[model samples]
Target: MKSIKFNRELCDFCGTCVGVCPHDAIELLESDLRITDKCTLCMNCVYICPVRALEELDEG
Candidate 1:
């Protein structure tokens, strides 16, 4: 399955990835972001992150 990975060092918690996710899979917590099982791996979050903090991961 494909999923989203967060780079905390690069993330500013702007919530752009959460806002852009079509599946409502991304969440912006007080301290970090969360990826739920609802994620469809659409890559919308990955593309929308201005800081490039979100990454796509392949788990085969």
Candidate 2:
């Protein structure tokens, strides 16, 4: 399966990723961004995030 990884250092908690992810895989945790579900690896969040915090990882 594919996955999404967030660069915590780059994330500004702007919530831009969460809004772009159609799978609802992103969320806010204690003011920080978090991945709440398995990513479809569509790269939508990665491309939409202004901070460029999200990444796609192949787990095959």
Candidate 3:
């Protein structure tokens, strides 16, 4: 299965991913980005992430 992966080291806490999530599956913490279970595998956050912090994880 393909899912979203968040890299805390790469994330700048910019909240850009949060805004782009159609399902509101992304959360911006003080230092972390959270991908919620509300995610429908849309991959919108993956494509819109400017810093490449979010990516498509092929867990197959």
Best-fitting candidate, scored by lDDT? 1
**lDDT head-to-head 2 vs 3, winner:** 3
Which model scores highest in TM-score? Answer: 3
Report the Cα lDDT for residue 11, model 1: 94
lDDT of 3 by residue, 1-60 (tens): 888788899988878778878888777889887888899988878888889988889988
lDDT of 2: 0.77
Question: Cα deviation of 31 in candidate 3 (Å)?
Answer: 0.5
Extract clashing residue pairs from model 2: none
**Candidate 1: pairs in clash:** none
Model 3: residues >4 Å from true position, as ranges? none
How would you encode candidate 2's per-residue C-alpha lDDT over 1-60 as one tens digit per residue?
Answer: 677777889888887777877888777786567676565666888889887777777788
The predicted structure with the larger TM-score, 2 or 3, is 3
Deviation from native of the Cα of residue 12 in model 2, angstroms = 0.5
What are the Cα lDDT values of the candidates?
A: 0.86, 0.77, 0.84
Clashes of each: 0, 0, 0
Q: Model 3's lDDT to the true fold? A: 0.84
TM-score for each predicted model, relative to the true structure? 0.87, 0.73, 0.90
State in Å the error of residue 19, model 1.
1.3
Candidate 1 lDDT, tens digit per residue, 15-45?
A: 8887887888877888888899998888988
